[model samples]
Structures are given as C-alpha cells and as structure tokens.
Target: MKKNNSPFGIGGNKSTVSRREFLSKSFKATMATGIAMSGFPTILPASVFGKNAPSNRINIAAIGAGRISRGHDMPGVWQYDYAQLMAVCDLDSLRAEDGKKLINDYYTKRDGKPFDGVKAYTDYRELLQSKDIDAVLISTPDHTHAIIGVAAARAGKHIYMQKPASLTIKEGRIISDVVQKSGVKFQIGSQQRSSEQFRYAAELVRNGRIGELKTVYVGLPGDPSGGKKEEMPIPKNLNYDMWLAGTPEVYYTEERVHPQVGYGRPGWLRCEQFGAGMITGWGAHHIDSAHWGMGMERSGPVEVWCDKVDFATGGLWDVHGIFTTAAVYANGVKMIVSNEFQNGIKFEGTGGWIFVSRGDYQATSSDPTKPGPQAKKLDASNPKILQSVIGIKEFHFEISKEHHGNWLEAIRDNKSPIAPVEEAHRACSACLVHHIAMKLKRKLYWDPKKEEFKNDDEANKMLSRPQRNGYQVK
Candidate 1:
C-alpha cells in the first residue's frame, strides 16, 4: 500500500448538479415536442454543449491492483460514463502507483486537461474511510474478499465483487447478509449472465425449449500444483505481511505470491491459503450459468460426490491438481464437473443439447457426445437452435446485454442486478461445497434451504475454516 498523501481526486472540492441525463432526456423531449434550441434548428450539435460528457460520475475506489484490475475490471469501469476511478488501494506499492498513473492518464486524455487527483492508499480501510467514494470494485484474493466486502457494505458503499464470493460458505453467507442489510447494489462478476450465448442457453432451459433438462456438464480447467517451499527475502515495494493478512503467516517466496511489478499471472491464486483454485475461480462462472439455466440461482445442489484425489505435497502451493465433482439437484438434475471435458457448460435436455462458453456456442439434435469430439467439432448439427423463437408465456429475461451497464443501472434504480448478492452466494456455495466434497470424498447431502448438511456433523464442520490469528471478518 502506498502512503496516503493529499486525498481528494478530480471532483473533490465541488458539488455540482448533473445535467447529462437531464440534457439527454430533454433532447429526446425536444425532438418529440418539435422544440428547437433558439428556434434555429430542431437539434444542435452535441459538442456545442459537451452533451457527450457525463454530468455526474460516481466516484469509485478499486480494492485490488492485480492482473484483473489492470486487464479487465478497470477497463470495464472506464467504458461506462457513470463511473469515475478516483482511488486505488493495493498491498503492492508499485501496482498502486501504476493504477493511479493509469487513472490520471485516462481522464487527462478524455477531459483535455492534466488530471492527477487520483489518490493511492496501501490500506483499504483508509480508502473506505473516504466520503467521496460512492462505490468500490473488489478484485482481491478469495480469503480477503469477504472481509473487504463486508467492511465496504458497512461503510455504505456499493460493491462489485468478483467471482467466488468468499473463502468459505460461512463467509459468503455473512457477505450476503451484510450486503442486504446495507441496501447497497451488489453485482457479482459473473458476467456470463449478461452474455448472449449464456442468456440464450439458460432461456432455452427455463422456457422448456430444452424439455425437462436432465444433465448439465460444467468443464473447468485444472488447478496448479508443485511449487517449491524455498524461503526468500521479501521483494522491495511489496508488503508481504499485508498480503498474508487473514491467512496463516509463512515465509515469503516468489512462487507463493507474484512479482510486485510484473505483468504475469499471480501465484497466490494457486495456493490454498489464498485461493481455492479453479474449482472456485472458474467454477464460479460455469456453475453460476448452470444455476441460472436450472432456475436455481437462489438454491444449490442437494448432493455432491467426488472420488479420492491426492493433493500436491512437498510444496507451498497445495491446491488440488486434478479432480471431478458431480452434484445432483432435487429435481433429478445432474451436473458433472471436471477438467477432462471441453471447457464450457454442456446442457443436455430431453429435446436437444446446447453448449455455451466465453467464445463458443454449439447445439445439437442428437447427443452432443454422440459423433465423438472430432465430429462434434466439425458438424454444426442443430443450426436451427439459434433461430428458435421464444413465444409468449416462455422464459423472459431482464434486458442487460452488458454486465457493467446493468450494474450502473441497478445503482441508479436501487434495484437488484442480474447477479445479486444472494444469487452470488448460491453460485459460490456450489463451488465451495464441491471443493469440500473433493477433499472428503464423501456422499454428502445438502440442504440448500438451510445451507447445511443433513445431520452430517463432519460435513457441516467443513462449511467454514478456522480463521488464522487476527483474520476474522468483522
């Protein structure tokens, strides 16, 4: 975290009325009412009054300055006119400085002025204490997610929490409760819900276009393993102690974390102390899609089964390398999750089957697995599936083609976004439970309504991990 110095960013000293929306609405009304500016023309050039600019922007602070912040979340927030990157907080000092520089550069180019008001902080608590910020984007590691989210909610800031809501089931439930109590618009980063491919596939199931959905297969990549435990001196400009805050204290290693100033993948994601591996990371995406397709966004599996799998030993990173989990819902719906299959959710219904991923969508009249992997890749069997018309009384959806758009709209309307906090908890719970099952290799029955196991003491105990020393979420 960088030392705080001279807090307020661009719009700190003034409170001005927002005229952007007012002008847009007035523009439309003027056209409708045959009104004109000064009676010269029906509409004037928008540039004459800076109509393209945002009148009011919500001040925002980013909680993490890692790869996601630099690569995805920051860029996504920048695309929206309703948001302003006012501050950045990261344990990595160099990343924090870089984040602030990026914000300054972006706004300077847009506003035609040298803007250097963006603040930088090493401690998130200090950032949360600011009254200027209206919201926060949390892209921290899994263990730190719940704590920051809970604190941000208590501080009365809207939040955009990334996938895998928390480190444990208990943490997720607490985050859900806190977010609801705060009445803040919480949007989970399960952006697939806003994508056309996933939306169409889910609607097909929800509307019974795919009659009586039977089996859903979610394919996620394997977790990393086998990093050395060689202790090394902490890298300069990196706060190793703060990075390990809320996790067990350990000797610092390059492979245990990431280079403070590097642009490659971080190592904390593969360590159990900081993350639950792809089971929760990628699982949050596909499983949320499955839940959406099955109309179980507020519910989870009734049973989860996994075979015994060995975790990587003799290394600092001990997360699972290879494993598979099968979850069964109450309505006889089965979902097979593994890394062996193609990376996506394959929806097999009685009528037909469809598969959806980030950049891939396919449909088939026969079994998707029938013609084998090669033929399945070559033959686009059910080309007509994309043209299937959704009639009245069929599954309808909230129209939000872009994820960030829905979040901003929800903030304005105080309405629930497509990926609300409770829905996120349910989605993340599946991943947590799957990881637990893979560890125990048990036939566990889940009571989704109660969010617990059915009289299974051992399984229930696994719902929450004991927080190390001073790491508890307040």
Candidate 2:
C-alpha cells in the first residue's frame, strides 16, 4: 500500500485515501522492516517474508482524543511494546495537536527516538483510511462509537472502543455485524473485566460462593430531564459538522460542543437527539459489571419497567436534571440500574451478600448473633476475596495478569478480545431496552434471542433511528 501523504500530512484536510495506495505502501514498509530485522550469515530471499514473517508491532490511531483517551487509552497502549501510536484524530485541532505532543514526549522521555513522522488529523475518516494504522482506539462520546467503529472495521482495522458501546440498540447490532463480517478484533473499554478484584468478585459469584444469586443491584447516577439551556457560538477551532456526525443537526451551543468551562455539565446529555443520557453513559459500566458477575454475558433482561422512581432530580443535578429506569430478567431476577444511587454493584443471594465498587469489595456472611467460623485475615499478597476464600493463591495471580494482558495478546494473535463486540452489544442492548421503555413511559417485553420487542410496535420503533444522509451505517 503506497501511503498517501495527502489527507494526513502537513497540508491535508479531511479526505479519503485510495485503498490500493494504502495496502501497497503498508506491504512494502512491512517487508523492508522484516528483511532488515532478519539479517543472518546469509541474507534470506524476499519470498521468505511472504506469508511466513512474524507479525510486527501494530500501528494504532486514536479517534476522539478527549479526556479519557489521555488519562487511560494512551497510557495503556504505550505500556505494550507490540503496539505503537501512529496517529490521532479529533474535531478540535488543539486537542489533536496536544495528543500528538503527548505521545512524542513520552517516547523522548524514555530515551528512545521521538515519533518524528506521527500524523494528526482533524477528521477520523482520513485516519481510518491510512494503511499504516492497524487498529483504532475510540474514546469519543457515546453516540459516535458505532459509526466510527463500523467504518474502522470496514477499513480493515481492529478497534478498542470505549464503553456504552452504542447510543442505540440498532447501532450496537450494526457494529457487531460489521466486526463479524470484516473479521476484525474488537475490545470494548470496560476495563473492570481486566481488574483483579473485579475478576475475583465475578468468579466468587459464578462459583456460587454466595449461594444461588437471587437478585443483583447495580447503581449509577440518574437520568436527564432535558432541561433548558442558552445557546452559544461554536468555537472557531472546532469543526461542528464532524462532531455532529451520525447525529441530528442542531444549533451549536458551547455547552453541547466544547468545554468552555469545566466538564461539569456537557450540553449533549440533555438532548435526546445526540446523547443517551445516563442510561447509556454511566449505566453501561455498572450494569455491565452486574451482567458479567451474573454470568449473563450472552443474554440480558427479557422485560423492563420504566416507572421505577429511582433517579436524581432538581436544579442541583450536574448533567441531566432528573431520570429513572429498571430492568427484569426472564428468570425473575431484577437489575436496578440508575444514577439515583451511588455507583457500585451489589449482589444478594440466599446465603449472604457481596458488594463491589472501584474503591473496594466487601462480603458479609459472618453472623454476629450465632457462633461461626473465625474471620480470616486479609491476604496482602493476593488481595482478592475469592482467591483468599478458596485458598487458590496461584489461580488468583494468574487471573490478574491474564485479564489485562488478554487484549494485547489478542491483538498480536488476531483473536477475539476478552470483552468482544458481541458481548458489548448484549450489554448495550440491555441499557437500550431501559432507555426505550423510559422514553415511551411504559413497560416493554423483550425477546433477547430475537433482539426485538415481543409485541409492542411503539417501543420497537426506538430500536434504530434514521441516520443523516452521508453518515448512515451501511
């Protein structure tokens, strides 16, 4: 693939590169690097590099280099030698340039050669078409994940996308299908699955340490009331059209587009057209953990009741003023996912209960009223309750390392990621059901296997939305 300097280099704006140029340049560069690295007593023939060369380091590009990209994704990818940051894309030129500087500085500080040829793009499509990029990290707003992810898959790039994978049910399905068809590896940004404490907690629940699970309570911040706000001019540096891709075209407002102030209250959350409120944002994480722990990654609730009054309200609220929602699984198990409560996952079983959050994990089974076994001391070496309880210290350590390392290994081996596209779609589907039920102000029955509403036509209408002309998912 001949790499086109245009659409990516100095004078490039937003434009697509020819596929033929992309593939030929990438192949030539890869073969040259392989031959140079494989020097021996006698030079191997060029044919040896074909279909037999070991996979080289993957070149990664990041789309939507926002706050989370800087805080988590960039550092995570940098930690692995098998991946290299090649390009960064953002609607705001300033943020995109800042990310490029950050990556270059990291390499320079490490006593390695600085990234002299790293590219920057104001448009993600241009980055997607670059044959140099093997994968993309999507840390954009919740609504844009599906469109960019699908496009990246079609362009033959693997993806590491942030959570609440899609803003709508249909979008999630479309992303899953695209990845499957393209044979691209995908890892959703639900990092808790890669955490030691979380894995132990999930293992304990899956093994019935807490007895048969009766119910799970996953709490997140509440929903939005779509409150009124004043409109402001779009910043000069921002390309508002690209930012609103796949979303309805509405008048630009500072609160909706950029963070003139702090990130306190983003305007996009209050609008039904561009955001999924808290249900798809924060709920995606907490509820995803609940489903993971319950061993329901492939399935979700069969019905959702939206009249539940568990949500935050009033002018005091930061993003959306007020909202509430609840979901019921087919086996009579209920999951309450709302911003109304503090962020965490609580499981109540017949034997006892366990609670876990980002901060800590606690299990209460010792009865003070009656004589019982003495409480064991905390194991500092393992520090995971499930391992400590079962005396399986070795398993604990291995699981901890494997979870985080799994994504990198998957990328190198071209295998499905730990939390792959299908699983993410299922988690997002559960939240989408709750969002739809709440919007229609009614209880809705769902057919999980079919991925549709059982009988409600009005509720099913919210499954997918009409896309703006050029931005529609194919």
Candidate 3:
C-alpha cells in the first residue's frame, strides 16, 4: 500500500525504504566523522552530554510544533541527557521553521557550542523518513493521533504521543493492534501515571489501603465557552488543508486552527472535528488515573450513561460542552466522570478515601492505623498521608518521576514505557464512550473485551467516523 503524501523534496513517489538500510548508512556517516580518532562516534545527542555523561543517546523529532511543543514537549526533551531533538514537523511552515530556531538556540546556549542545521518539515511523513530520529513526540490533535501513531509504529520509531490515542473508540483499537504487533516502546502523555501523588493513590487503592475500592470520581475541566467564531481566509504561512489532514475539509478560521498572533492554545481543541472537547482533552489524564487506581487499566466499564450533554451555544466548534457520564464496570464499581470539579481523580473506598490532582493530594482514614486517606469533614492538613510509604510485597507501580525521560530510557532498553499503547487505548476508549452516550442520551452496555455495544448496532456504528478522501489509515 502507498504511504501518505510526502514533502516537496520527496514528491509523490512512494518508494519502499528498508529501515536497516537507512540506519546502517546513517550510522556509517556519523562514525566516519569521529572526533580524535577514538573509533567511538563523537556525534552524540545532547541527551547524553549533560550531568549524566557516557550514555547512548537516542535521536528524536517533534511531529506537532505548536504551543505544547514550545511550552512542554520540546523543552521536556532537553531535560534528559539521553534524548536528542533532530527535527520538527508542523502543517504551518512558519511555526515549523520557528520551532527549529527555538530548539537549536536552546542547545547552543546550554552546551556552549553552536548546534546548527536543525531540520524542519511541513509534512510529518518526510520527518519520519529520517533514520537519524530514533523516536518521535506526537502532540497533534485527537483526530490525527491514531493515523500518525500507527504510521510511526510501522516505521519502527518509538512514540511518546499525547493522550486519547483516538478520536473514536474503533480507531483506538486500530492503534492498539499496530503498536502491539510492532512491539515498539510507547508512552501515552497521560503524565499522571508518572507523578508521585497520582501513582501513590493508585498504589493505595490497588493495595487495598482504601479497603475495597467501590467508587471513583474523575473530575475533568469543562469545554471552552465562547461565541461563534467567524470564518476567515487562511493565513499565507499556515497550511489549513494540511492541518485538517484526517478530518473533513472545512472553511479556514483563526479560531479553528490556532490564534493568528502568538503560540497560544489552538482553537481546534474545542471543535468536534479535531477534538472530543475537554472530556478527552483533560479526561485522558484524570480518567486514566481513575482507571489505574481502580485496577481497571486493562479493562473498562461495562455500561455507561451520560446526561446534560451540551455543545457551545453558537460556534463552528460542535463538541460536547457540558456533561456528566456514569459507568459501571464488571466488578460492580461505579465511575463518575463530570466537568463539575477541577482536573483530578477521587477514589472512595469503604475504609478510606483519597483525592489527588497535580501538585497535591488529600487523604482521610477511618482506621487510625493507616495515615494515607482523606477525611470527609476535615481539610488535608496532616502530612502523614502524603508521606506514607508502601511496604514490601505491597503493590508498587513503576517509579517514573519524569514522563519523557522514562520513554527515552525505555527506548534505549527496548522495553515498554510506563504508559504503553494498550493501556492508553483502553483509557481513551472509556472517555470516548461518554461521547457515544451523550449523543444517544441513553444508557449503553459496552463489552470491553469484545469492544462493542451489546446488541446496539446504532451505537456501535458511532464507534468510528468517516474518513476524508486521501487520508484513510488503510
């Protein structure tokens, strides 16, 4: 099968290239220029030269060079001494070029040496072709996650992609299938899994610290609120069509793609065509934490019910604006997902309860013996819960403080990262079903093992969306 469109230099030709041939030649080129004739390749990635020296560094590239790249992902790569940024890709030509400048400048100043000639491309296909890049950080919108991810996995590049692996549940399945078959190290950007507070809460629940986990509340931020945005001509530097690669072609508007002036949050985040709104936008993190705490990362709720499903009052954006979704799992545990609270997860057990979000956690314990629980009436002023340690033989989740760093180490070690692709798909699937329930405004039973709605063809059909011409995943 033919690959997707290529960049200007590669053209329309779709010639098959073996990864071995590409990497063999690339290694030869790097080794040929070894410094001081030491025989060891001196062209090490910036990832290996920092405080932690004498380590093999993996080459990396960024797929979506947007606000997140500027603010988080790209900078995050520079944090570790075992990963290097070699290229950046974005539909917007100006942003792609600008990202190259930013990445190179950071290295030049920090390393006290000129790091020049960073490659930038408008098409991700071209970027993925480079054998120099051992992995890719994909922060594209939800609609493109599955297609880009499956392609990167097939291309044999380790992937650290943002969460909600798919806009629809079925596409999530497709991603799961490919990543498992490819056996590449993959981490979903649900960073909660990497943090101490969230991981500790999950461990507490799994170890029965919260005796018999019975209920979970995953609080996600609500959708953005704004009046309709008027359509406008596409900016010369921005490639609107390319940005809408997988979704249906639509009129161009600054609000639909991104802000015209600065690298702020992209407007596609609020549109149903590009995103599933805040439910998956933020739910991907908290809900994944909820799943982990309840010991349901591999499985999902069996039934779901959503109400108060809303869309923005009047805007090109048509994703759900306000909603509450309740799900029941096979273990008879209830999970409530809503926009009623700040972004976080709360687990309630018969003996204790705990609520944890970014940077903080609260706990109360009915049993005086355990110090790690949140009390119903008192604010969490006690430090014992936060300091509680897991005993030997108790459940201990993988210790990963740095999210991107973990993926880099996993890539070098040829192992799965903390948030592998399947767990990401399952977590995203749980959040996606709420969209289905919201649309039908009814209760639905989903067999997670079967990945289908029970005897409900109408709901099952909503599991996938129609792909635009020239963008099918195949």
Please give, for residues 175-284, the per-residue lDDT of candidate 1 as tens digits: 99999998887999988877877777787778776678999988776755677688899977788887887778889998888765565666777898887888888899
User: Please, what is the TM-score per model?
Assistant: 0.84, 0.78, 0.84
| Error at 67, model 3, angstroms | 0.8
Kindly list the per-residue Cα lDDT of model 3 for residues 137-196, writing each as its tens digit: 998878889889989999989899988789888899999899889877788988777777
After best superposition, candidate 1 residue 334: deviation in angstroms?
0.7
Residue ranges of candidate 1 with Cα displaced over 4 Å: 1-55, 308-310, 360-381
Regions of model 3 farther than 4 Å from truth: 1-55, 360-388
- lDDT comparing candidate 3 with the true structure: 0.76
List per-prediction Cα lDDT, in the order shown: 0.78, 0.69, 0.76
Model 3's TM-score against the true structure: 0.84
Query: In candidate 1, which residue pairs get closer than 3 Å at backbone N, Cα or C atoms, i.e. clash?
Result: 1-122
Overall local distance difference test of candidate 1: 0.78
